[model samples]
Target: MSSVRSFVNLIRPSIFVHCEPIEDPCGPSATMADLN
Candidate 1:
């Protein structure tokens, strides 16, 4: 899932903004709501 990789990349930076990596390993759904 290339999209998943991209998603991870995009969200990786946000890990600090939200400070919730494990709880929301999926990252901020808001960023990829359309894909989900």
Candidate 2:
């Protein structure tokens, strides 16, 4: 479960980068805060 979470964390940034302009209203920095 933790490994899966970590993998998701790794992949999320890439997706976030691509989708950020379209989907992320709060932006990557906010997402990073939530992740932590």
Candidate 3:
């Protein structure tokens, strides 16, 4: 169960980024390019 949850957690970020990439954090410095 724990492993399944971890796997879901791993895939979740990618799914979220695909859903809303602009809202996802890129790095230490946020870029306006993402907004554009």
Best by lDDT: 1
lDDT of 1 by residue, 1-36 (tens): 555656776979554332334356666685666865
**Each candidate: what lDDT?**
0.57, 0.55, 0.51
Give a tens-digit lDDT track for model 2, residues 1-36: 555556767988454321224257776666576665
Sequence-dependent TM-score of model 1: 0.33
What is the lDDT, from 0 to 100, of the residue 2 in candidate 3?
54
> How do the candidates rank by lDDT, highest first?
1, 2, 3
Tens digit per residue, CA lDDT, model 3, 1-36 = 555556767988454221223454674246655554
List the candidate 3 regions with Cα displacement exceeding 4 Å. 13-36
TM-score of every candidate relative to the true structure: 0.33, 0.33, 0.33
Model 2 poorest 10 in a row by lDDT: 13-22
The C-alpha stretches of model 1 lying farther than 4 A from their native spots are: 13-36
Candidate 3 Cα deviation (angstroms), residue 1: 0.4
